[model samples]
Target: MTERQHTDQALIARIDPAALLERTRSWSAINSGTHNLHGLTHMAALLADAFAVLPGELSLVDGDAAESVGADGAITRLEHGRHLRLVVRPDAPVQMLFTGHMDTVYPVDHPFQTLAWRDANTLNGPGVADMKGGLSVLLEALRIIEAAGTPSLGYEVLINSDEETGSFSSARLIAEAACGKCAALTYEPALADGTLAGARGGTGNFSVVVRGRAAHAGRNPQDGRNAIVAASDVALRLFEARSPALAVNPARIDGGGPNNVVPDTAVLRVNFRPGDTGEIERARTLIGATTRAVAERHDVSVEVHGGFNRPPKPIDAGAARLFALVKDAGSAMSLDVAWRDTGGVCDGNNIAAAGVPVVDTMGVRGGAIHSTDEYLLVDSLAERAALSALTMSRIAEGALS
Candidate 1:
């Protein structure tokens, strides 16, 4: 083997699968759900301790308070957990960003809180695949890279606490870190078969509040403006706005009172996935037009909250080069790396929107994320870590220019 191949093998050999699995198990045991403040605090502390092994300045950043429209049509502040940030060699010529999340979809009250061995090769549990395992792999890869003493590349690590809930609290932080970076890597978990997500569509979440005059249904039904009816009409109109480029889902509606009284308040919660910028514009136009017509016809006041936080991530030349570099690294390790377009959106979308080339799924191979059946391929712990280490090493060597 050539000297370079020998050096790569030596770095890969330092990755210990058993230690990675142990870390994943311990991290997943904590209930760091998006809304679980206490759990997230605990998880953040643990992460800070684990990531302290790296050579950098680490800090716990307080997230901005997020806003939410309540069922009573009142806007309220939603608190999120603190995020972990680590910066190393910031003055270096080549800088990169590495990001992951500590929060899972499963809340503290969720029953699937324990981990189990599906077999000798698979492990299942909360946040195992969708991304506690990914976080472990990321830390190991960075540790290996640091051990190799590559002085050409500097990187910043951002582990936010609110990614599963649209990253509202940490969006600005992500944008700041992504600025002026040559590339980014996000550990959102690859598919079970080791395939990564390519060009991802953008996502928006909206809450529409409808207010109407309430009156006794039996005594003055005609005099009362029905807010429930108006809300339903808005939902239908938004649903019809769905097209080939945009997917609209009106997830839920909250409002209504006793059967004897006309409802005075209703809130519609909807999500929109736009394939491109044009579709995002179309979605906004549809929302404005539909809400205006519904309000006029029902004599109600309409309010819209929320917006398209994640922009669509297309495969630009820079992104294509990053993917090719990753694929080549995987091939060097006798692994086949492939990606396909997906509708799912993550912090990667926000990072790519900042004009940074990012290959976001540099995590473990797993399936059934955001569900109770989520599992991680046990062997991928070392495999993916090695892949990321080699990829970063190549970037340090100026292979991505």
Candidate 2:
């Protein structure tokens, strides 16, 4: 056998599937929802302890405060859980970034809070596939590489607490860690059939708050401007802005009052997805024009909060090279690694915005993410870990130019 084949066999043998599953189960049991501070703190501590086995400087970095417009048309500060960062061999020539999130879409009060085996090889639960399993895979891969002796590559591992809701708090930190890296890998679950995400569309969220004079419904009603009507108009105009390259979703409007009173406030929550950089600019322009026109037509004051946090990630030359490297590594292990464009956005978009090429779905093979039906293909734990280990080793050996 060739030297590379022998090395691959040794690394694959060291990954224990049972251990990886157990770690995922234990982490999934905790309700580390994006807004569950207590749960997030507890989960963060456990992750730090688990990742401490690696050779690096590990620290829980405080999260930045995020602002959200409330139902009452008030902007409030939101506190997020701390992010875990580990840097090893910072001075090494070939540096890379690996990131995953600890948060799941299931809130603390959500009913999907436990795990069960759907079958002999399928385990289902919240966050199990969407990322606790991915975390386990990442750690196991790193462990195998370390056991092989000192690695020639340097990498930074970032496990942040806010991703399901958007990586606002950890975005700056992600960009900072991505600086000067040769490539990046993010552990968002891959499709059950092992399909990865290729070029991804960008996403933006906005809350448009409208203010008007309040008046009694039975008397002087004409003296007051209807904020709810104005907000609804804004939503419709924004929805009409959708095109082949841009998708607009006006999700919720939070305002209205009892009869006999004209409601004076309304907040519209909307999301936008742009297919490319030009589309992103068009989306912004649409928002500005729509809000201004609505305000003028309805005679009400309008305020827009939020912008596109994730920029569109088109496959550049660097990203294409990284994907080719991953495909070659998967082929060596008899795995067919393929990808297609997805409308879903993740930290991958943010990292790519920093000019770093990233293969984001380097995690367990799973499906039904963002829902209670999420399941992880139990066998993929070791399978994907070995794939990652081999890929990183190839890069360390100067396989990519």
Candidate 3:
């Protein structure tokens, strides 16, 4: 082993459990939903303070304007809060990009508002495992690295507020920051067993609004072309577009009226994950054709919003080497690091698209994410911090290129 490896081993042993848990507790308490601008702004300020431990200029940059369709089919632009950008030694010989999201699937009105202990070592709450715990791991790992000494490898940390909603506003920022970096790590939560995500499918979320003539059910119903029925038809077509490689999910449908009225407006929200770039393009074309065909067939007007944003993160040679580095780091601590392809897309996908190799699920081990049952294994906080510290230190030492 090299002298740098010795230093890495020493630093990994310095992982702090108490501080990690405290940070997680602090972050998970806030409900930073994608649409909660106030909550996200507050969370960004808190994160800016916590990340101040590292040598970096932490600043909040305004996110891109996001669009939402109203019930009347009017598109409105909304802000995605602010994105936190941290730069440390950007001119250093080695460059890396680390990313995560501060937002959660839960909203302010969600009943799962606070963290509760499932057991002495298990903490449950929204965003606990999904990413708040991951951010804690990231912070501690960087602190460990900086404490060891100033690193030769400079890194950029982007904590965007809109990733839960497909990174509508921060995709450009993520890609631009990753341009010159050799490697990237996304702090999305890992499985309970500490496995990472290897290849990830590119995902696109779409909202299709259908409009038709509305009429009272008890009156001349024939004068109305039911939009709900048209929207349902579009939903079925999208679902049928799925294949063994392309996974399509008709997540939800909104804008239905009372039973006594022939509903003339309906919105269908759907998401699809494609295994590769070609598949993503195919999905787009198919969806467009299907939407037009369905609209014409049902005599309705259709409007579509959103498209594929993150390109697929394939486990090519570059990505495989990156995973090997992480797995080796894990093995040093008697931890067997493993990974598999996930259909779930993340900001890591965007980074990988920039030709940077990335291991996305480097966060704390947790499960039952995006739900009330979300929980984090408290021990993994210290364990994964050590693992990340080792990986980062090695990367800084020119072990990975």
Candidate 4:
């Protein structure tokens, strides 16, 4: 194959499992929830500090938070920003990007938010399995490659602050970094059974606001149009759009009177996931039609805000090739690895949808993600990291044909 691939395969032979696990535990102790600005900042700084020790020049990519006003004054956006970059080789042709998120779903006050030892071989923590553990694995993987003292391809690592809530502003940055890159690896945790994700559905979050006149409930019932009822109808329409492969969940409904007058306004928070672009278009059309029909029939004005925040990413031809490369690397290490399609979407979907070939769920294998039982297998830290390091090195060496 190529010299880069050969170099990567040779390095995978000497990856140290113990060092990998130690680092995973180290990072898992820090809680970096996407909604917790302070925690996110601390996590970012920690990552930056750690990367500073690497051989390549490190650069920070700046991002700003969107703000809103609250009763207490102006409420700053929850997440501060993210860190991204390229760890370059003196000379290289292919560029590979490794990606992971520093943010988790758990909030600062969450009871499920700290690191604990499930056993000598397992780590229990909020962000441990979902991704902080994965980040650790990525770093260890890179360390293994760097220690080999052979460079195959220049690489970049993109860590973002806002991934649990759909990546918002960071989506564009991911897309931009992916341009001309050969492949991408996202360190989202693996399935409970160690299966990597081959394909994932795209996610879209939306809001529907129903506006109706408010009047005395008992004295002037006819004068008031119930926005709540209009919103309910809209919710029902949304659920009716669900199919076997597609899902629609109306997460929350807000607004209404205290049983005294008609509700002037009501809002519906809805989210959906579609496996393909066609499903996304169909869902958007259905939502629009249903919203308009409900508004007209109920005599209420409706405003629909938000659109497909994250496009659904399918395992296209490019991704399939990328997955094979990872699998090959794993096999060489005597690890039997396989991939399956998943319904849950992550930042990988955002990158893949932008036309970059991605091997997501390329993180430590673990179980119970997003729950109190969340834990990561200590052994997976080294195994997966070695797998990643090998893949990158092989790609550089032109080993995979």
Candidate 5:
């Protein structure tokens, strides 16, 4: 091994695999769903204790209230947990940002709660890969850096509690922290083959409430408007709006009544992912037109909620350089790292929107994320942490440029 590889190994040696896996297991034991306030609070407290081992000013910031339209069509604030922020060296020459989410998609009622050994090298659980293990990797990398002594660069860490729900509450915080930083890293779990996500499409989740007049199906049915039919119109229009690069997923429809009655209310949920800003604007226009058309035809009141929350994450020149740095760092340890464009959006989109270069997936290699079969590779705990440690150490010493 090269002399620098030796130094990286010495630093990575501090990342004990057993300790990392144990920490991951402990974290995975907690059900910190995006909507589970109690679970999030518990997980946040544990994170505070674990991250305290590093040198920084750690604090929790409450997530901004998110607004959602209820069945009665009333917009209300959705409660969420506080976000964790830690600033290690604000005055250092080089600046970087690191981010991860404490929330998972699985709710408290979800059956996939416990971690079990799928095999000798794989552990399966609700969030073992997407991404309690990622946070473990971030903490381990930072621990190595702190042990190596003072860093030459400044860095900020933001572990938010609302990333799984579109990061609406912590969007401002992420943008504020990422602004003016030279580079950013988000631990969002890499593919089992080690390929990180590259340029991403934008995602917009919309809820269309269709309200119409109800009447008895047996009497004067023509006098009443059907909300379910109206919602179906809107769904069809949304489906027709799909383009070659744009995807439209009609997720669910809520509010239906007995077959004898013409339903008065129906809610249609549609999710769209656009390839770029052009597609985003066009999508918004098409959605507005489609909803208006359907509501007018069915004589129903339509209220649309939600929009493109996460903009596309395009890999610009600066982001490419950041990717190159990670590639080089991985190469140093004989780990070939690569990336490909993805339609999935994450906090990396918001950070990249702030004009900061970001390599979003620096976490452990895993598969079947957001599913009951989600599994984390046992050895990736140390392997990914080592890659991150080398990358961070290089950035701190200004060797990345």
Candidate 6:
């Protein structure tokens, strides 16, 4: 191994994996799904309490007025309940931020809310792999950074109560906090095989509502426009628009009644993903044109809702540098660290879109996210925490660019 690789590996080996495992296990026991406001509050309070023990200032940033940027570039604040932010040494100008969400996709009464040990090195539970485990890693990483030595690189930790629901109510707040930061680390879990996600496709959800005249099927069928048929045609057109890099999926169709009546209203819920902005705009144009054409043909009024929620997170120079730092840190622990671009979207997309450089997959390694089988590798807790600590250390020492 090269001299730098050897030294990094030595530093990584010094981190205690056992302590990380215990902490993750304890945290995995909590249930904090998106709609579970009470659970999220409890988790936020727990995080606030945990960070309170650290030698830094902790303040809870209100995420209530977070704005949602629409497809047409219009912004509106969405009410998403409540959120929290804890800053350690917030006044430092050169700041590094760590972000994670306490809310999981599961609801409060989900059957998978409990955690159990699959083996000596694996723990299974709701949200364990999706993010609660990552939260533990963040806390431990902070502890290690403090133990290593205090450097003047300022840092803040933002733990939101709503992320599993697409950050509808916290995006603006996240953007505000992330602005002006030199770099960011988000605790989204790495792939089960330990691969990081380097780039992510742009994501958006859309709904087309069609209004038509309803009539009795037997008496005045010709008088009705049959909005359901128009919506079906639209759905098929959307599905046929898929290409190698872009896909359109008609997720759901609503508003159908008795068979004896011509349906007057229909709703089509669709989702699309494009590799970049150009493709996103192209897809949007196509969708808009198609919807208009279909509505005109059926003589029905059409309304569209939901648009690009987050922009694509492309690989920028800042992200590349962060990856190199993380790779070097992983090598110190005898691990091979690499990442690939994915079509999946996350809060990382929002932060990157806000022009902040981010290293997103700084959480535990695991698989089966958003499923009952969600599990996190116990070893990655310490491994990732150590990597984060070292990265923060290097940033403080000015060894990282």
Cα shift from native, residue 210, model 5 (Å): 1.4
lDDT of 3: 0.88
188-207 per-residue lDDT for model 4 (tens digits): 99976679887778888877
The TM-score of predicted model 2 comes to 0.98
Model 3, range 333-395, lDDT digits (tens) per residue? 889999988888889888888899999999989899988999999999999899888888878
Q: Rank the candidates by lDDT, best first.
A: 1, 2, 5, 3, 6, 4
* Model 1 Cα shift for residue 332 (angstroms): 0.7
TM-score of each: 0.99, 0.98, 0.94, 0.91, 0.96, 0.90
Q: Is candidate 5 or candidate 6 better by TM-score?
A: 5
Report the poorest 10 consecutive residues by lDDT, candidate 5: 65-74
> Which ranges in model 2 have alpha carbons more than 4 Å from their true place?
none
lDDT of 2 by residue, 298-363 (tens): 999999999999999999999999999999999989998999999999999999999999999999
lDDT of each: 0.94, 0.93, 0.88, 0.78, 0.90, 0.79
**Candidate 1 per-residue lDDT over residues 267-330, each given as its tens digit:** 9999999999999999999999999999999999999999999999999999999999999989
lDDT of 6 by residue, 153-206 (tens): 678777887777677777787888787788889999999888999999988888
Ten-residue stretch with the least lDDT total in model 3: 65-74
lDDT of candidate 3 at residue 100, scale 0 to 100 = 92
List the candidates ranked by TM-score, beginning with the highest. Answer: 1, 2, 5, 3, 4, 6
Candidate 6, which segments miss by more than 4 Å at Cα? 1-19, 64-79
Off by over 4 Å in 3: 1-5, 216-219, 256-260
For every model in order, what is the number of clashing pairs? 0, 0, 0, 8, 0, 2
Error (Å) of candidate 4 at residue 263 is: 0.9
Clashing pairs in 4: 2-397, 2-398, 3-397, 4-396, 4-397, 5-394, 5-397, 202-312
lDDT of 6 at 142: 79
Sliding window of 10 residues with minimal summed lDDT for model 2: 144-153
